[model samples]
Target: MPKQITRAYEERLLRIRIMSHTGDKIHIKLPLDFVKRMVKNNALDFLSGKDDIMDSQKLLNLLINAFDYNLTGEIAYLERNNGDIIRLIID
Candidate 1:
């Protein structure tokens, strides 16, 4: 694990809905600024389920060299610099 800097957007953005033992619900929503930032950074395509999504040369390099990669068959990249890390465990 790496030292994670608590991003401001982490508090305002990305949310998760979880159910407690009491059958309560947790609602979470991603921050607008964070989403905008990611789009500006060119990582926003991952937010949308677009298979034909093609990354530019720079984004590719960023994904490979300066970023952490934990790809298992599918390439799932979440913004590490943003609020609440969201992991959509798909079956």
Candidate 2:
């Protein structure tokens, strides 16, 4: 039988900056483990395609729409489980 796995405490990771040509910038911080999981799950593959690439503007708009209300001026910690999760601290 497989052993049971438990969720560990979430930790802070890296911050990504989204800059626009109008000199506006939005900062988003994500957990390291979460990012690794995303890569492993090919969550970012759409952005890496050469032929049918996702538009940068559309991606940015989606991000902003999803995280606009969660913006923070400073870094913050979030509670998360070991299951697939994506938490963003946008500013």
Best by TM-score: 2
Q: Residue by residue across 15-82, what tens digits does model 1's lDDT show?
A: 33444445555554555446446656877554343442434444444433322232222223343332
Per-candidate local distance difference test: 0.40, 0.44
lDDT of 2 by residue, 1-91 (tens): 9764333324434456544445565666666556556655657443333543345345444444433343333232322232222233432
User: Candidate 1, residue 7: CA error in Å?
Assistant: 20
Residue 79 of model 2, lDDT score: 24
Q: What is every candidate's alpha-carbon RMSD to the true fold? A: 15.1, 16.1
In candidate 2, what residue range of length 10 has the lowest lDDT sum? 77-86
Q: What TM-score goes with each of the models?
A: 0.23, 0.37
